[model samples]
Target: MVFSWRKKKPRSFNGDKKKELEIPRHFLCPITLDLMKDPVTLSSGITYDRESIEKWLDDGNFTCPVSNQVLRSFDQIPNHSLRKMIQDWCVENRSYGVERIPTPRIPVSSAEVSEVLFSIMDSTRRLDQCACLDSLHKLKKWGLESERNKRCMVANAAAAGAIAAAFDAFAGESVDKNINVLEEILFVINWMFPLTEQAQLYIGSQASLHCIALFLKSEDLSLKQNAITVLAELLSCNQKYTQALTTIDGINKTLFHFINKPICPSITKPSLTLIYDIVSLSNENTTTEFINMGLIPLLLEIMIDSQKAICEKALALIDQLCETEQGRGFAYDDALAMPVLVKKILRVSELATEYSVSAIWKLSKGDEKALMEALQFGAFQKLLLLIQVGCNDKTKEKATELLKLLNPYRPGLECIDSLDFKNIKRSF
Candidate 1:
């Protein structure tokens, strides 16, 4: 399916036309129709660019492109011979505008990965911090280069454990000179997400936990973001990790700083994600920390001014916070809380509706002013619309329950049923 580039005649410097030759057909990838820089052969016995074919397989495609046969495996065998030929061809055709393909770094073997891990560990213990950081940086580069290397690195049990040990070493030091190196180590760990169960257990240990807690204060945005991302992953590992994170002092304040100060969008996203994960864990002290930190007002501000994703996450945190009496009281005390809650009911996504409705339900029960305020803010119509259209069962139930709470204060259902909603677009 590859097509050759067409030659075109253009005026030369002397005012005479010259023809440009087309790229060779076999030199191009069948999938991309571009020169195959890193050629690889799949089980289908066809050669294609490694990146193009890997993308195809990554998207869940399993059949051969030309033969239409199911591939035996997604494993790609490097077409070393074909790649050498392509390199030779590109070198010979340099005058024709062909760029020589750089040699692809070979994926590391399991033994090589273990060797690197042990080397890093030994260097760190010997206080050769410079060498340890250099080895980690190299491993990080390899992991970023290809999915093959990433898998190999993760399979080596010592990889994550060694990184955690190095963090402990640096954090325990009397000087701050190696803190930047720790930041680089954190960045590498973030790249290798979802560590193995054993690795997670090791990294989530008390010493490593304390080390990462210190990283939360790092002035480097990348380091701080990576630290939070790793914490979120650790929280997902099990209850022990969640409990461990909950005990870290000032964790909630550190996370909220990103939201309030407004760093780059990359930092904001993970900061919010970590907040959601902490709240979702439902740890009592963690919830109290979030509430006592004046997070409700800040969350309301973010929900009001942020994009769709941040808005949804802000609302979700508000929802979880409302589950506690302290959270409910804090939210109710906020000037913008009720208006923002009712406005988000039908305006944001389904999850937002569910969370907002649940928050309103918690606030409106037996609170005459809050219930009346909800109805005054067009919540009655919005609730009926939510039930009329469609949302999750929990959302519908909360909406229905809130409606019942407002029943005594309502005029009648006839007006609600007769109202026109043709122009209203329900987010759910």
Candidate 2:
């Protein structure tokens, strides 16, 4: 069926006389030389159909024949009108020709582009106003539309120039003035999770823990480092933001998942610091969950493998854990395994002896059998060695106190000692 559709002609450049332009071969794909085809996406996510075009794209050859500049995704084609025009031209040409072909469209002009830009800016401004007024209903509606708009904007080039202006405005002082709006902006950038997807997307997956994990997985080290700093800040005021961490599945999963990843020395140190903070906030339920999930083993592994600073942080967490009744229960429950744990602690290169001594002290408060077992394992020798080796002054004081508790006294000696030693001195 033949269909008649009105086609918009390309705007002409200023000149007295019209000239017929010759199409460049470089602009044509060698295999298809008739523009490009199916537009298949490559493994690397770049889109191209022709082998030569794909090679050029892969080899960092990114320029529009029309624009003569580096062609980013949006720069290649910038608006729906242009995109539709290209598709229509392809269809029309195929109807009249024996060869199946691809058609390319011309880029749009600046002034027509400005009108679209103003409309988007106006819409964004309205949404921002709604967000400022806490109109979640309107915000949600506009937010979804904005995302749809993003897909188009990402595919368009001329539209992008206009959109860049909107972004500049979005990032300007006016948006900064609204703290809530700014927070909303951040949430959007983080890809705000719906309640259902929140668990699987953020909590269950490793990337869900922090945006940094995503960046890290993608090998964006700078973004990953920035994320760690942000995580530190998030955890620093954990008392205020505890709900955000625990209530969100992704946040909770991400925090725990880090325990299992190969520790980066840079991240490990800060991670241990965060662990200490989490331990400090531990309740019976949280501590039990931590213990049940093998937190102890992971922590012990870290202590044995990590640097002194990390080991110290681990020990501090253990100290805090043992201070709680539930934590004491965990210690006692794992007391049968105490000898093995102590072995690992002793094997640690840095601060092993110090942590071993502390572990012994903590175990002493566990079951009687555990205490007796600890003593039998030469815990006293380890403790004394730590003290003699210039262990922290506090550690020395604790060792002295524990030694007093472990020492045995004879009944007869106690009586003789209680007697008036000064008065009996002459007789002696």
Candidate 3:
């Protein structure tokens, strides 16, 4: 019960096995208390494991984890000296099962990022295909290095301008000629998420957006996934971009591809989210576009087959869409809608259950046909179970109301989902 790995242990069976030795306190990360594999120093003058500190900052904490001092700058430098010392310690204790840490590559610096960005622009301006392609590849590698590099690169105000200018260089080039470079550029731009400031302006224009739309229609799923995700972030940054997205030639239909015939679930989530974002911005007419695109039936299909997380998202979208009269009519028309909604009442997750029940509640608000459908699809029984089992107060209210709405259609037999309904007796 009082075992400790820090204390030295007796030698193992093999004579070559050395006695386990305690790891020096200084060699351990202040945060993790483990030997630092990739030690990095924050501006607050405290060292931490790179992953740990980045996670701390990423979680919205601006203060140093150990010092608890506010960090003015999120920038951190690799504690090369500390890392080397830890590596040596690992080697010195290798016989005790301590493995040597791999040497981390140097973090890309601001100056290097600037120079590479300049190289990309210069190569594009000079029509140096080889040079531009090479620089694009290099920049993507830096983007791939770490999240810190992405923050650094995106922080550069010219990053968006650089990407747009490079894209303009391919104005007349055939798609196949520089497809790789095009993909790389998208990859780099995507890394600069949570687009703060006016960075979105560079590609938010009609021309730039049209180009992105082309990529969205690309037969390549990887390229299309990147384009939709990038568009999703942009829409999140400013709903103004929605106009340019909708105006593009059949671009709205391109988004439909991911949700309609999703080649990858990765693409479907954003597809649903983007639709939600767009509908949230505009009115029910925009929901009409989605309905006309045959989104309702497909949504029901995704909810039935997708995993819980994806199903939750699909359910939320459905609930949002049903807020519109036309959207509600479409859902009511779909045979799967009531059945799927009834099945998801207490199934899936809390959010999914809420969305499913709410959608039904809204659809059946003043319609006798819809209420009959709910009962025909076993919505009465599901709502009964939802009450017998415990749920949040808000959900309980909705379930109770639905049960009341369906009480006239309740079965003649006694309840079977539970032995009693004492918990919800007041509602009855």
Candidate 4:
């Protein structure tokens, strides 16, 4: 049976096409007239679904829907009796294909949030791993139920504080065994974002961020991405966080670890983006460290197989990294670097191709091996083709310079004839 916005007619087993099962009027919200999944009574003593009343109030209506009187107070109490009655009715009408509404969860309250966070912090402190996991799981359930529940937890002092404390307890311990416990805590913390003052005091600390960065090595892809995302959120809160990120021990190496391993794009995008941002803040010493930690090879790895967006991200980062000698030297040492850069010249987006061309110009400057690598990979042919297709002035200059270098190597190379790029479709 079709459900109209104003009313519902769940089909009954009697199978009379036009016959409708009569529903009790009190079971419906006054505003929607649909069955109330979570009934609540307002200050006017008029009942409505909790979701409907909240939206009504959000829409700036302080008057009761039924009484049309200005509500003196906005407090809404759950109508448990009516909600139970509705559940019972839905059960009795199961043959009519109505789904019994699952009992509505009690919304998270500040005091209850404090209690759960206390459990997590206390259990972890005592090393009672099972009890700690149970409490974190409980809090995670509430946090996942609704946005309202998340706001309540974020408002609680213990919520973010305890999460930071829990991680502190296991900071340097081997993560392989506690990955499950870590995942649960991390997910709930993720929900409590736009960190409040209390939350930021703990999560924004360098100690806490270092602990969170440990999960970048997690073999579990989703968990690793969650860790990266959490880091991104916290780091975004303070520009100085990037400066702090560079100082953490093995932090750069761990971040580079996942980039070398080609995970899904969801993981790669944020991971690479964060890496790029952090490196952008690097001084001379930090830039050398990132290169030594496999930043160059990892970027080549990403550019080799990634889609347009990720490929462009990798190229852009490489272009920035190439500004330093260590970046250019490290990239030159990789045999695949020139070929990868040359291949991307005209294949990816205009910006990606431009970055590719620029990096090639920057890396091959006054270098024999780099220039030969570009020539060996047919960079000369691609460069000529890029110019004939009409590039930005800067790119045209770079492409023209690359052509001059390659001309000595492959002077016979010319743009491919009659190239109708209008029909040449690229996934990237």
Candidate 5:
């Protein structure tokens, strides 16, 4: 009876009941604190979850202890503070031997992979937006890694990405705003240069070269041509890159392998064009290396089998070398110059006759013996046939002009004109 006077000590429910009695203004989920599970998202883009309300009340997030509606959705939650607390807890747990988890491996579908690559290329286009050239440079590396670090995969992806980027950049503008991007792409390609053997095989020789040659077809032809010309110029200046060119096993194989392949009509022209450019560079050592790699035979084969443009380009390159001091030294023992000229004259007989006449004109500029040898090889007959072909009137005039030049001396003059150059037209 006296216990009743003590008020029964309020029948204490232990500290657990006191701890559970607290409430809060806004509740958060125990797992994801900003909102509760199964949130009711509103038209205003707000979310509410019952579990978050319960946790907030249990954790004293609500101010009213007896009122269950103390939580309000309009009231902002302490998301930032809660996030920091959780992060600190994670750090502490990690320190206590809870190993940090790695990102789960994403199983990317092929389509997703393609979309990601497209997005990357799109971002790469905004090269100026990037903080540094290194940012743009890393794109290729990322793409390569996505392709599983396999060289073929990397090269194929890079080639495709580079080509697409170049096309998009050059599509409409003449100023080439994307030149910097293109240069970065080329820089990446140059990094792969040492690995060109794998690339060439992966993309095939023709496709590989075609991709490289895309720079040549840029709308800015000067820029395009300059890219190629600079490399030659560099090889001319720096013996190191030139030596690299000389020792490039891939290029050597590409240049030399074409020789033994049968000269089909379809391939004849391009093969010759490639050879022309390869030989025309200013690098004497590289040129010499090409020559020593048996380029003369290839040139001869092209001269005999190629189209007019191919032949002209090839002959001009040869003419350039034949006029050089180094060229003459190289040609001293090699019958490449004379025999090629003779064979061309005999083959096309009419078309080549003009080239032969021009060749003699060029040879006469320096080596009289070369001129005489050209003439003795029925050069006069070929020249007359050129006039007889009934070609453009300008070509006929050129033939007449060459005839006059060859016979500057009276005896030679009479011998050539005595053949009745004008009447020779009807005989053919």
Candidate 6:
């Protein structure tokens, strides 16, 4: 069995047509060790697949993966020649089931973004506005091409500010004249999240808020959804802007309209989320406005209709509403509210359970009917089950207290033994 090393023969394919093909080392991304579909050169003179390098940088990496050198800058110049070579190689290896990578479109430059923005604001004429909107649409389409392009769009302060200003400009225009432009503006803002505070201020300004409020009135479901989302973002950015939103004529009523007859699931979700954000602020006047607009009954219907995150949000909002005497009175009196609230515990998410229990606890205080209703609805079973299964400490405490409150009413309730009662007594 002895063999000489120098006498070994090279292996043959032996007519095996599906033999593995070799890929050029240069065509592989250094980071991923895979073929580079879109080779891009970094400022450190290292090459990587565009996605690989962008992800590395986006995850807070500042050094080259191979050299460990600090990246001087983040500009990623496309290696077109290498990309074309990879494409040709893929075409040459079509028998191996290799697919050619499509050419990537060039990202829009800051100058181009500025030009379109200038065109948009430099004129008030409808025809000119329409043309500018077309240009802006093309730019947006480019930005949608890749995260690289989105970063380019965000880096340009002028472009971001111009977009916010465009909203203000269109806000003042007659809806018949500028609704299309307004829609595009909302689209752009939605794409550009984490907007600069300055831009947020501009969007939250009186005029911009007015435009969004007006958008809610439109028959366009998509527009109304976008408006609600943008409005929600604006509220989160600055609490001061909430007063302006509440002051808008028919804003609360418009929100309820979407809640009642949702055009689509997408529209309904965000509308409910926006309501959650608004009511969570706990502004007396705003809350009163919501109550006056019949928010309680609408919320109950929405709860019956939705589950998952939307239901969680509905429950959270209800928790806030129940803090007020008026809201509590409305909810407690509703035949559907108590049972629905009780059923949510141990049923939805832990957060939903907490919200439901809190609302029930609020209603139960100094209200014999509320306490009686909860026990009659098997609240004791759900509360005991919540404690036996793990929940957050605050939630467990609330459940414990509610159990204690209801214990005198049900002496034979099985879950609360001597140890449980002792633990609850000691926690105080």
| Pairs of residues at least 3 apart in sequence or in different chains that clash in candidate 3 | none
lDDT of 1 by residue, 235-331 (tens): 7666567666767777778778878887877777777777877787756777887777788898898887678888887888888888888898898
List clashing residue pairs in candidate 1.
Answer: none
- Model 5 pairs whose backbones collide: 23-60, 23-62, 24-60, 24-61, 24-62, 25-61, 25-62
Instruction: Give the alpha-carbon lDDT of every model.
Output: 0.77, 0.45, 0.76, 0.77, 0.45, 0.77
Q: What are the per-residue Cα lDDT tens digits for candidate 6 across 1-428?
A: 32232243322212235666777878888776677878999878889988888888888978877777898888889999999999998898777767788997776777876777677666533435677588678767977787777777777776666677777777766656777887888887776666667778778878788888888887776777788778877776677777677778887778777777777767777777777767766478778888878888888877875758778878888998998999998997789998789877755688888899999999998887777778877889778878886788988888999998887777543332233233332111
Better of 3 and 6 by TM-score: 6
Q: Per-residue lDDT of 1-428 in model 5, one digit per residue for the tens?
A: 12122232211112323232221223333223332223332222334443343344446554322232344443333234434443444354453443322222222234443554455456546543233244444545554543333233234544444433433343223224545654554544433333333233322223223433455445553444433443333333333333334343455445345444633433334444444455554367666766676665556566766666667656655655554465555544456666567545433434454554455455555565665655555555665665665555644665676566556432552223234333443322
lDDT of 4: 0.77
Q: What is the TM-score of each predicted model, taking all chains together?
A: 0.80, 0.41, 0.74, 0.65, 0.37, 0.81
Cα RMSD of all models vs. native, in order, equals 5.4, 20.8, 5.9, 6.8, 27.2, 7.5
Candidate 3 off by > 4 Å: 1-26, 38-97, 118-134, 168-178, 277-293, 323-326, 347-354, 376-404, 407-428
lDDT of 4 by residue, 1-428 (tens): 33234453432333234555766878878777778899999988889988888878877978887777899998889999999999999998776667799899877777888888888878878866678889988777887798677777777755776786676565535455666776777777777676655556566566557767777766777777778887877666655678777777887777676677657777777777778778777677877877877788878876777789989989989998999988887887888788789888875789998899999999888887777777777778777777787778999998998888877766543333334244554432
Backbone clashes counted, model 3:
0
* Cα-based lDDT at residue 286, candidate 4: 77
Regions more than 4 Å wrong, model 2: 1-222, 237-239, 333-356, 389-393, 408-428
Ranking by TM-score: 6, 1, 3, 4, 2, 5
Q: What is the lDDT of residue 414 in candidate 2?
A: 22
Per-residue alpha-carbon lDDT of candidate 3 for residues 196-246, written as tens digits (9 for 90 to 100): 555577667665577777888888878888888888888888888786677
Give the clash count for model 4.
Answer: 0
Clash statistics: count for each candidate: 0, 6, 0, 0, 7, 0
